[model samples]
Target: MTGHVTKPGRALRRLLAPLAAHAILIAATAVMLLPLAWMVSTSLKQSGIGLSRGIEWLPWRDAWTNGKETVDVMVLGARVAPGDGGEAVEVGIKSLASRRRFTTVYVPEGAFEAEIEAWRIRPLTGEDETAEARWAPFASVRRRVAPEWGNYREALEKMRFWVCLANTLAITFLGTAGTILSCSLVAYGFARFRFPGNNVLFLVLLSSMMLPSVVTMIPVYLLFRELHWIDTLLPLFAPAWFSVNAFAVFLFRQYYMTLPFDLDDAAQIDGCSALGTYWRVLLPLSRPVMATVGIFCFTHYWLDFMGPLIYLNTSEKFTLALGLYTFKGAYTTQWHYLMAATLAVSLPCIVLFFAGQRFFVRGVVMSGLKA
Candidate 1:
């Protein structure tokens, strides 16, 4: 009887364990995703309203009806004052500056026409020296969800997004290709060839990874400047051709070592040279590692800011990462436009990661496991 009762309790605990773990994981995921959610929310919000006092998850705007037509308005403030018709309510129409009202209107107490004061501007005419301000009662004002989808369009235009995007894509594709080819060749040699000082050379290469990039930054800049590569994209993608990334080479070499030696022997028996064997047999079989390395290289090159900032002097040659910096001026930063452009720029990386996630995980796992 005790065994039977305990078995049921054990089964219940087993079920609850996974449930509790999943609940915790879901909560952690939500926490991690909160900033991204806020970015999306702020990107859609109207300007000047994004920094509201409270957390607003949705893009909401105030609309006011003046009994004739409804129009969007900015609510300044409200106050109560004495009037001929009972207690009167005073609402400010427009705000010219802090603690100052551009226009004011009076409304009777308990009147549906006057709850709060709000202001909207009319299109300026040639006869008008300034924009015409229209005021309405607070009772006619209603908060509604109105996402400013045009923020993306305006932001893109301001950032010269297409030009930056083209430059970024060019650098990313070229650099990614170079990294894969150069790293794979070097890794293959390290994995398959047996020569004196091979391990020592690889150790030296690995040790280079520990060195701070700042140590080489000035020397590299001088070298590129001498080569007349300054103010050009050459400095950005050119280093990939030399297999500068020790991590990518290490990944490829590990994956290569996991493959059987018999495959190399069979390829040799079939009259395939070392290069042919690598291109035909090993390279084809390294899809997972290739996808992993390609994604890493793509992201690095796509979002490289310091590289572009140092080498590319002209706005026409700017990458998306550097172009986003223009949204911040000496005085004010356009947070809405910045967030919108940031979200737009980050979409490709997010999509690429999700699409190649399976291969990326497989590559990392398989690279770690020895045959």
Candidate 2:
């Protein structure tokens, strides 16, 4: 009876240990999520104080009393051009009265441009222009109070968003698929076969991994130009098929090395060829490593701004990273629109990461066990 009671007590302790570990993990997870929460809070904040509408210009006050000089509002990027086009303009206001700055206020892109242009053409307007023109001083003061939702709409509409998104997806999918296939095959060869000069060849492949990415970028560009692959997705996807991912190959090789050789031997004994054995036996058990490789490939291509910027000359082929650049001006940037676009663009990556969270955790844990 005492032994039975002690056995149950031991089992309870084991269960409690994992429960305690999970509680600590939950706390760490919350800590990791704080910055993202703050970014979201700022994105949704209104532009001014006591605005009835849910949305306000920028979230904070304008102007600062640092007293160096009355700082003019600096527009980060304009969402829309003012006029009949009706795009929204992103505005930054520095209010001398409030002594703070407003970062992401929306004004009608058309309205902002029209306001500035109207000021430029003010002398030419006849007295009969309108009742508003007759009361120009009051109009000027009231101009700052209007909401500018059209600017946001206009900016969102102009940027071929769907097209850019499609291009990005195509590149990422093809790149990841090709890289995994080629890297896995090459890795299988290195792990299983004892060919002549195998060590030397692998050493060469490993050495290329140490080369700076910048050093080869120009050459890659030139080669792509010669092959007429630039400005298209071909240059982006084709490299992976040709075994460009040395690190991936190395990773796959390490994983394959730990696979039981008896399985390969058994397959051979059953009259299976090398390719058949690999395909039939080894691949079936390779899900963890494949998932690991997939995650890496997805992230690398998804966040690759420089590659798309250099190769994709047309707006139609632009990735999200390239499209985001449109919000920037020579002297200003539309922070509101930029922030909105940034949050929007980041959504896909976040979704993918969470969706694959289980596989990612499992694969990474299992992969290290072997290597």
Candidate 3:
């Protein structure tokens, strides 16, 4: 009886453990996604109302319907006024200070408009300057979800998004290809060949990763200037071809070391040269590492802002990251448009990660296993 009771208790505890863990993971995911949700919400909202005091998850706006047409409006205030019959409800764009002075149009006491007359407010156009005050009944106005989908269209147009996207794509593709080719070659040498000072040379290469890019920024800029590569995409992607990414080389080398040396011998027996063996046998087998490095390089080149800012001068040469900066003026920013553009710019990276997630995880796990 005691053993059976304890077995059920243990089973219950096992079930609850995964449940608790899943609950925690779900909560954490929601927390991490909050900022992205807010960005989407802001992107859909009307310009002036997006940053309201209250937290609104949906894009809502105040809308009013006149007799012929309906239009969005801002509510001002309401007041009592002398009607033809007697004192009745009055609502208008007139301010409280000037309410008594402005001419009022009173609605009948029994009218539906009179029931909501107290809720009326000023239109977005501001105080009525006309001799007669302009107002709408509160019953005619309502809070409705009206997302400004046009913000994205307007943002793309203003930011020259297509041109910037093209430039970013060019740089990302070229740079990712260069990183993979160059880093793999270096990593192959370190993994396969026997040479004097090989370990020391690799240590020196790895040490470069510890040095901050800020230390070399000025010197690199001067070198690019000397080469007349300033204001061009060459400065952005050319260095990638030289296997400058030590971490990438390290990942490749580790993954290569996991492969058997017999493969190299087999390739040699089949009349394949060292370079040919790497190209056919080793590289073709390194899909996981390649995917991992490609995604990393793609993300880096796609979002690189400082490189483009320092090297490229013309607007046409701007990457998406730098192009987004154009939305902020010296005085004020268009927050809705900025949010829309940001969401648009971030979608590709998000999609790419999800698409290559399996390979990325496998690459990271397998790379460290042997080394």
* TM-score ranking, best first: 1, 3, 2
Cα lDDT of model 1 by residue, 92-128, tens digit: 5443123344446555545423322232222222322
Q: In model 2, state the lDDT of residue 358.
A: 77
Q: TM-score of each candidate?
A: 0.80, 0.62, 0.79
lDDT of each: 0.78, 0.66, 0.79
Q: Candidate 2 residues 1-371, lDDT tens each?
A: 99988998999999999999999999999899876764454344333321222333334322222234433232233344353325555544444335465444444443446655322211122333443343333122222322334434544555556777788888889999999889988999999999999999999988898889999899889999999988888888889898899878888888888888999999999999999887888876787777877887887787788888889888878887788675454113444455556666778878878988876676567546634
lDDT of 3 by residue, 1-371 (tens): 99988998999999999999999999999999999999999888766534552578888766656667666654444456777557666645322233332333454444524234234223333323441233344444566777889989988888889999999999999999999999999999999999998999999988897899999999999999999999889999999999999989998998899999999999999999999999999999998889899988988999898999899889898889988876555214577888889988988999998999887676567556734
**Ranking of candidates on lDDT, top first:** 3, 1, 2
What lDDT score is found at residue 242 in candidate 1? 97
Candidate 1's TM-score reads: 0.80
Of the candidates numbered 1 and 2, which has the greater TM-score value? Answer: 1
Assess candidate 2 and give its TM-score to the true structure: 0.62
What is the Å distance of residue 343 in model 3 from its true position? 0.8
Cα lDDT, model 1, residue 99: 30
- Tell me the lDDT of model 1 at 246: 86
